[model samples]
Target: MAPKPTSSIRSFASSDRFLAEIATDARRPGYVLAGDESFLYQRCRAGVLAELAPPDQRDFCLHDLDLAEVPIFDVLDRAQTPSLMVPFQVLFVRGLKTLYGRGQKKEEFAAIDAYFRRPNPSALIIFVADHLSIPTDLRRMDMQDKERFERIRETLGDWCGIVELSRVDEGDAARWLAAEAVTRNTQIHPDAARELVDALGADMMLIASEFEKLALYAQGKQLFLIPPQHDQAQPVADIPTPTITLGDVETMVLAAKQRSLYELTDAISAKDRPRALALLHGLLNASDGGEDSAIGHLYMLARTFRQMLIILEKNVRDSRAIWSVLWHGFRMPPFAAEDLIRQARRYKSRADLTRALRLIARADLEIRSSPPDKRLVLERLILALASEPKPAASGSFHQFAIDL
Candidate 1:
């Protein structure tokens, strides 16, 4: 038979994977149970420790007993016996379905009932886990999953309480870096710290290791200086996006006005006028139901032209940042922001910019005010913006404000 296709979900080899692997003829040297992903890595170590130790600090180890076939009296003796040869012993049985609902299998009611009745007293029972996914098969099984979970909690009694593991959220990454910097006495600016997050791209371990590098590099170096050695890492965090800049915000604003005129121009050059205008109409609707949006669109076109002039004047090679600036303001549609900068310069002319902005202003007015033929008005606006005239110092900014 062909092998089952692998799961497409992209979490760290998650607890669910571990659980799915448990007792499906993949048993370890000992028995294994399915568990939760959220608590898997964390509880595994401590659970293993507990399973290896004596339950009551009595001088005994579960290893001394035949895990497969120890007699009741012999096992009882082992638990009661104080010994120099053996220390505390814990029995290990995993896969508590109470903590983790059965995913594609039937609930092991009989197994659970038997296990609870004669639980090896030496074992420090544990339920390790990740995230939960209710299995499709269980929906047809009539398993009262919640009730079973409650039953397990009752069976465990005071012997076990749920222990939570800490996972970091996006908001905490910057603060974490700042703390790391302080610990190492390195002056990591907030932007630099944020860049660290970007570099690691939400990989917490990677972020942690990089922050450690900051500490390591700081040693034997001047306390007042951060060495240039650590600057070469091309991690996204180093991209200097500490806070949302005004330019970045402006791109989003322009994008909301309609699709970016700069991008549309390429389509127009390819004689794809309809496609170009569609983008314009989309931007036109973004400004909300107001005349200000019309005006805002014009200013946005002017601004893009302004940026283009600046780039040309400065003779800047950093085209990527220019595009990021556009993505932030004009709200470029979702795609990689890296390539759009060079693209922005392609359909460039001051005249085109002026016309596009003027078109946006007109669309904003028609959409907002008492204008007839809304659809036709939009189509006209799209054409005007997509194939705007060359600049001649005729830019209009009639105040397009979004009423919050």
Candidate 2:
């Protein structure tokens, strides 16, 4: 008998159930898609469009609006007014945070309440609440995010359905990667699945994008391995299946390139400012999006710092122990295990690693604020991270003298 499958292979119930509702035409007047998981959000969007707005009818039926540009009253008016060209309409509204901005906007909530009370039968609205981040374990949610989610529940939950698009668990991501490869007539080794998910920090959007490239790479490998025979009559036996291995994942995925990221961290941990700056430039130059990819770089940096923090806290001395300390999806690649442990040990204390994380977080905020020179912002961040913290004076408090 075949071995029992792991429970981690289960489908994404939240989005899948929402899709089922769409298919059965049991959707509410509006829905609040709560979370920043882009992969699930896209899946939900595709399902809605496929069911309500077919290709031919999309021109007349689909409306994409942002609250920053359009007011809630205008959106309601458009929803209420029947379209002569189409029988059904779908509206996707972004920038939902604008609604809950400063001041108690009783009028907006009242308007939303009134519209849902007597909603149009032919219209559907999807409010994207991506400003918040919901982790796989809801109990560990950020305090501020918990408050925001509660406010949303108290307000939007009353009328519109709330569909959460939380972060995909590492196990689920690995299973999904394996299952997805089967659909393309390819096989992904279990090790490869784990490596891919862990290397990309279990960010589903990146995993999906990189998986496509790996699939194509695997196809090319198969073509090269089994050369086309000139005689059509002869059939070859024992053909090897096209499979993606852990090596392939490390080779193709940019983040999986251990040398690129680990080397940068090595320099940072050693306080090699010049080398760190050079490595940063090399990373930016190699990426398809030079300055624009600053956020991605910062994410990897923050993740690495967090991993190091855990390593220090646990006193992980070897590669084997590192695995147990860092959970699935958050672990570094095997080749970098020793390197990372060494780097983590270079830190004097947990406070130093947390300080590094705070600097990275600040850089992330500066990048998102639309800085005129993103490269300069990253350079400043690197310089601060690579510099040694000044010793505290007798009277002064102990703190890292961050220039940025």
Best TM-score among the predictions, by candidate number: 2
Over 4 Å off, model 2: 1-11, 230-237, 259-404
Question: Tens digits of per-residue lDDT for model 1 on 248-270?
Answer: 22333222223355555456444
Tens digit of per-residue lDDT, candidate 2, span 82-114: 999999999999999999899898999899999
RMSD after CA superposition, every candidate: 20.4, 10.7
Over the full model, what C-alpha lDDT does candidate 2 score relative to the true structure?
A: 0.86
For candidate 2, give the lDDT of residue 60. Answer: 95
Candidate 1 ranges with C-alpha deviation above 4 Å: 1-86, 89-122, 131-160, 164-167, 178-188, 220-404
Candidate 1 all-Cα RMSD:
20.4
lDDT of 1 at 221: 42
Q: Give the C-alpha lDDT of model 1.
A: 0.43
Worst 10 residues of 2 by lDDT: 1-10
